[model samples]
Target: MTGERYPTTAEVVTGARELTLRYPDLCHLGVVGRSRAGRPLLMLTVGNGSRNVLVVAGPHANEAAVGGATVLRLAALIAATRQRGEDDGSAWHFLLCIDPDGAVLNEPWLHGPYTLRSHYEHFFRPCAAEQPEWLPHSGEAEAAALPETRALVGVLDWLRPVLQCSLHGIDVGGSFVQLTSEVPGVPERISKSAAELDIPLERGSSDAFQWPSPGPGVYVMPPPDDEVAVGDGAHSTWAHARRYGVTAIVEVPMWACDRAADTSPHPDPEQALRIAGAALRRDLPLVAEVLRAIAPQLGGGDCALLRTVRELVALGPRLTADWDPAVRALDAAPLPPMTNARVTSIEVYAQRVPLRAAAMLRRIADVPLVARLVDEWCAAYERAYSPRWIPVADQVEQQARSVIAVYEEMHV
Candidate 1:
């Protein structure tokens, strides 16, 4: 019932409390830890079975579809099973929004005419360096860690749950599942659920983060030693994976299309990636330079969001340099036949984070150059990608169902 549109932070918290109030014997609500902004970090516990499982969302702010939407949906599903005397003997622990402060910044589009325009217009994600889930792995730095990270760590230590699912979502594309440890039938189960829900499996590589894809829609988490460079560092899903049975990072697309999973060989293999690389090479440097120039104008005021905008914009040249050369090599390699997923990867995935950063910068500062850039890019998205909005209900269903499907597999 909570998934027609994304639930706001208040609505999510209230729902958890209400669930606990209505079924006090079955629901246990407790404060996990306080967030950086002094918000109480809440965790809702359901069932008293032997297996302790943790499902959390809101590690990335703007991914609200899975933030509270999936968590609440998962709760409702499990609760219904209990009412039907279908208990599975697995205690489920849930965190609706692990990063409450960051999530609050994304509430505007949560109650929306969900669209690419509306989403980018209101998007906000913390810089990678500053994300609570990926802080550097240094004992000395632990003291200065963001409270959100500490809160997450606190819960992880306390639960020591054998199974964990840290939920996430993409603005576009289709269902992709990541595992710190594999469950034999999980990938097939995810594909079946996606097909049933009409969400395709997004098998293409993402521009933002690339991991080892071992199956149709499954990504294997990189080893912990390489975690800092390729995956979430110090305190994250990987941390839980080391101490738990299997940690799953389940991602569902906010928008979907059959093209996401299409395997038909593309007419011009590698063209879309090359084109995307070219566009990034041509435009990123200019945005980076302009933002670098005006950065000092924001004197005496600095926080995560401002720092994130500046850092990502400044990183444009490096991003383009790395991307262009890699894609160019694809031109020479005897690569497998291209597919429609390549177009989805290039048009939507490649430009997602940077474009979102551009929109965010304009919101923070109305610089003419930045504003013009964002306007031009938005037009390009409409003309090239045809950004369709996947209904919120579909996203919630896919995310929640995927988690449950895997849990049921573990049970069996």
Candidate 2:
């Protein structure tokens, strides 16, 4: 299976170029820009029509593998349709591997047997503000702070697509979709596709609870004007895409767990969330201690990886911060609704403390003491979480088909 696994960042670039050459008229390969690491960022335009659609994938490095596969597959599908003279004024522009540097960092895990432990070992998710796809920029403010991010903004500015889909995946959780607008028939198509693939639909999370679901597995994407949108106005892909037309975020699960879909009401949900937050807050000191203890041994090598881990550790406190007031605010608000899925998700997060800490620890911890600590932490996390990992191929198939189904519905 590993031999036939998804393509890497380089392979994606190569494949895009080859596709353009093969379908000269239907496909046009162009450079968006270079990545931070000077890797060529390419886009493959798959149709020659007025209705522009932008499909972006591998915005997050860790997600590059499967996301790249999906993009490539979709490009081929669109190209075949175009070759057959089936194009009905639908043009697609594919931004392939926006964050090549990040993808390089995560290239080791592109092949299958993508377990949670393996994924966490090579995991690297940049801060919301720092990520190439999530950077803050409004209406051409000179240039975006990150070149990788700026390239994407440039494409959006040039295309002004009527439909946009950002390909993304979660390390865990069931399949879900976030749409800028509730387009007719799209949600039903997503539900049907995911059902056929046997991907469990994400039931209810507090984040999605605020927005009503048009159908199963689909949530109304929070708008830029929403108070919850990060970094004022320029952080989300949805923010930039909304000015043009509908934007969709298709989040297929990397792994499946039945518990992720449980929607039964939990007793005293607000207090439970508070308790979980408190537990996370309490774990901060231990995380800092471990980081401090292993700092000397980590050395100067792998600066990029080290910086990412440092950022992750730093984020722990800021996220933990100022929650007590919010918790109290929630407590007073006439018992907010809660679901078993939400509670279980929180429980999973709580159990992830040691594992998350260990992920950082393993990267810099060449020492026997630190290695032992990682092992102990992993064992503890496994005991608590009881992770049941589904095959990576299953997830990939489910995601690609689900997204394609939505795209088909969009065109219809």
TM-score per candidate, chains pooled:
0.89, 0.87
Superposed on all Cα atoms, model 2 deviates from the true structure by an RMSD in Å of: 3.3
Q: Which 10 successive residues of model 1 have the least lDDT summed?
A: 328-337
Clashes of 2: 0
User: Quick one: best TM-score, which candidate?
Assistant: 1
Summarize candidate 2's per-residue lDDT along 1-412 as a digit string, tens digits: 2424768888888888888888999998888898777888889899888878898888777777777887778888789888988978878998888887777777776664556556676666654545776655457464646888778878888899887787787655677777777766766776676677667777764345556677767777655566443223236666777888877777776666566677788876667677777766666566567778766666755565556556656766555332233444443323235677767666566556545555655665655654565566556555654555645566666666766666667664
Instruction: List, residue by residue over 1-412, the lDDT tens digit for candidate 1.
Output: 4457778888888888888887677788888888888898888998888778998888888775466877777786777777678877778899877788888888888778777777777778888755667654566567777787777777777777777887888876778877776666777888888888888888764532446666778776666676433434334645554675777778887877557787677776456667776676666666666667777887757776677877776666556443344443443323334567755665575566567777877777788988787878877766665656777888888888788777777763
- CA lDDT, every model vs. true structure: 0.72, 0.69
Clashes of 1: 0
Over 4 Å off, model 2: 1-4, 137-144, 206-209, 229-234, 268-275, 296-302, 318-336, 352-354, 368-388
With candidate 2 superimposed using the best TM-score fit, by how many Å does residue 49's alpha carbon deviate from the native?
0.9
